[model samples]
Target: MSKPSRLWSIVDRRIHPPLLPLTTQDSQRLLDTIKNSFRAQLEKEHGLTDTIQATPSTTATNKVQSISNATTEPPRAFARPTDQHLHSILKNPLFSHQQQLKRQVVPASSVESDKMIFKQAVAKGLMNITRAHGFLLKVAGQKNTEPPVAKIENHGVGTLVLEWLRDSGQHRGLKWFSSSPEFGGLLIRFLLAEGHDELLLIWLDQLMTKEVSLGATGEWGITSMVFRELIKAKTLDPTLDDAYRTFLTGMNMLEGYSLSGKFFSTAWRELCWSTTVLAWKYPKVPAHLFEPFAASKLAKDPRDPRAHELPLAHLGLHHPEKPSVELALEWLRRHSFGYPAKMLLPAGSLEMARCLERLTSFGIDTAQHLLLSNQEEEAKGVMEYVKKITKILREKDHGLLPEAAP
Candidate 1:
């Protein structure tokens, strides 16, 4: 105790006046003074006091209230127009023009909306038949995200147009349908389905003259459907030869303009089938439809001689009694020289041997033709194959052959 008291006395004596503890009120006053000094320095550095003093307090309060309200409230959603409103809008010329312009700029939204509007108009009976037909043509011509065929069929628009055509008469409708290839194909399919033969015939007649272009395969399919219908009709009533002839003329006209080999082959195959049927049913109907195919340049090409096989086989098997076989044989003889033995002979050895024997009976030497064509090895092979099959047949038909002369 003595040492602590002496040390404290010495420290207190070192200062001129000893320190005294302050009251709570004096400490509070000091803290207040320090806070005021700091606030003044900050206001001077940032110029915040002047800004706050210049701003109207009422406006500041209003801005705060507005921000709070914005945060608390939900945003309003866009309202889609009703079908009636869309119909009215579509009917308005100015609105329609704007939509057309929008379509040119941004096709996605405009096309879908236009398609919807068109469907709505048709459903509400707002658009007339002619107007609807024109609209469909315009839509078909555009490059749309949806396929034109799918758009027409899936949307029931094709059905609506079909109904109008049926009610208004197909004469005018055929013109409407023929305005576009898409429509033309749809019209043919509809006509065939409904058995509207008279109108279909008129459509086919018009198709020959019209420059409407269904793509190669599309055109082929349409022709096949029509031919099948005509064949069916002919099979049912053999008096429809005029119908068949009209189709043939139409096909011939198409063939003139078509450059597709597939087109030619498809046409020839169909004609062969149809001609075979006709030959069976009506002997008066000339069996020479294949003559045009045989005469065509396609038949003369040596590289793809197999193209001629189906038509020839059709004629040889179905109309064996007709002169078509003789015509086919003459064609073969002329072209056989260029053909490989595989192409020249039938697929099966037995069939080939019998075919050669038939050629021999016809006084046409196939081996000789091959040799003349510079296919000597192939010619020898044909002769050997024929001898083998003949020996086999003789062994099998021993009784058919005369007893050995003894």
Candidate 2:
């Protein structure tokens, strides 16, 4: 028994000798003490259950601030934001990355040929340098719609000198000039065509730093081709650091939001299903990050899974178990220089033994597949990905083993 119970026993024996019985006053006092102890135990358990963990946006010690009025009148049953406040919450997170990230529909009636369009973009010095570096200063200087095209062709800049500089091993020129936003976009396209994500990250640091348009949404539009190049170079860790960077760029666009600035009515339930699938796919990747993203979108109204098919099945999956669309999203959130395949490791899962069992039959040509498909090896630091996790599993089992007699 517990100390309180033992103390109660001692007090009971002292106050009320079993056959002699207790005086009414002593009996009442003893009952009160025992009742108080039970109440204290109940309060202690409630406090333990109420302990909250810290999250990225919220600190643990933050006592929730209530904005209610100190009125004698009855308080409003619910709190609601003002209309303008709703707009910011509904649209502001994607305020910088909108239209540009979505592929614009090329108008059928537009007269410009594809060749002419590319050539004009090239001519305006748009392809040559960024609008920031005075490369487009002259084009931007003219108060005409056609000036950008003229600068490209008239400059006899058939080829940008930066390419030659890049090839010639002039490091300073490449860094200074390549960091230009206009050049960064072209270079990204060029790298995609050539299959070079790793090489592209050489310039990605600069690309990410370019002024994000405060214009209500932007896309981290670095295409798959460029991502492939990085996989070739072998750097993608699906760690928190990479995830933070992804958030800064327009890459991790929250897909559930709509243009009309409403959560798709069916979105909540579908996202929950998606999160559940991730959680169920244990011994693959943990549900730590995935869980919340899924949960946050799970319900504008919990009574529905509004969108049919979750609208993500069409996206590709890497491991047979992973939902491809979700992985693509997570990767955009900041794989950094890490590979895309890190999520495949056993240690990433909730269970270790399952990962080990599955690893036994892992494909040998996974890296080659990445090279072929333009993705890259798995999503983690390759060496430690396997070794460190194996050690963790080994230690777990060792701890569980029974000791022999000395």
Candidate 3:
């Protein structure tokens, strides 16, 4: 079918000009007009009559006649009904009996705390109170006061306190365009403490991108150092099935290593230098990246003065049930390269006992290889280093003198 032509071939249409951009003066005029219109509307709505014209005249140019009923307007914007105000209004003697007659049974672990406590703590700010109290006790000082009604006993309190702070401390929020910088720092520190290194990275990413004014190196100093040490401590696990598993996962995490360079400073360098280097390349290493450090630093220095520390050499003195022979041998290779020479020496009673156990399980060649690797002088040196760090419980149990336990 043909299109309809009966529609008078259409009348001529005119295109309106595009809306003109307002200049500053035009904008001021418009704003003034809007304000006056709003005020007139309010007056009309509130029964305050005025002789405003069809074309509204500027109040600055003319005075309109006011209505006989018009009076001074009362102030606007009274106090908002906040929780405290609501409590004052709703609470009377009525709720006190209800609130107290049945006390809220708070849980020992938030694992046990119900949805209502979580919501109330969130809404009423009591959760923040408990979190801040817990943080203040744990991080702020050694002498911590109990939460108003903390029910934790023994290590239960410390463990639960740490858990609560980790989950609740950085209840992410912003009062303005920027986040709470104070909360960010505390959140990062608490996450690192709880071994939540991944969470720390996420927090840093938010701070860096959202708030440029926050000093990157200022509040972040201790947090970065803590991440390095935490990974180092984890690697010392005697049952390391995959030596790099935890570290690699943590480093590859989103926003991970955001503050790594700042963390590698002089104060923490000696204590955590090797650890920091290992953590730096974690999941994305090119394989050869670790070669230099493994060859240079770890090989050169395997002993720490802190007697409680795990020594690579001690881990290398393998029993069948101990660390892998391959790992022990690799560590031993690095040890020899760094140490250069051994100081193996005469036997001590404790050494005799360990030697006997190793000999019984790992055979003579392994012992002799170990004994031969560190000649008497070097063996004695490493054994002494081990003694310096370990409690030597076997020595005490067997009543062996330190001299014979060498």
Model-by-model lDDT, in order?
0.46, 0.34, 0.37
**Per-prediction TM-score, please?**
0.30, 0.18, 0.31
Tens digit of per-residue lDDT, candidate 1, span 1-406: 4465543453454423444354575455454544445555566765545422222456469678755774355553322223234554544432334334434322265445555565445445465545654555554554423232321223334544565555445545244443444445444433444455566656554544443454434444444444443434333334334534644554565567653343334444444444443344544444455344435544322336665563563345343234434444455455443332332332344645544444333222445545666878866765665465445444434443332321
Number of the top candidate by TM-score? 3
Decoy 1 TM-score against native? 0.30
1 against 2, candidate with superior lDDT: 1
What digit string (tens of lDDT, one per residue) describes model 3 on residues 1-406?
7764422222111112343455676556556555556656665766657624333354433334322221333323322223244545433322233444245466575434433333344344456543544443444333443211221123233233334443554444322112333333333333434555555445434544443445454533433444443344334333222233433333343124343333322212322222332222323323333332232222332233222122333323332223223543444344443321122213454444543343233222234445765565644544543443233433443454333323
Candidate 1 lDDT trough over 10 residues, lowest sum = 144-153
Kindly report which residue stretches of model 1 are placed more than 4 angstroms away from their true locations once superposed: 1-198, 205-224, 255-267, 277-281, 287-305, 313-406
Ordered from best to worst lDDT, the candidate numbers read 1, 3, 2
Candidate 2's residue-wise lDDT over 157-275, tens digit each? 21233343343344342444324434443333334334444455555443333322222222223322223222221212222223223222212333321221121222232223222
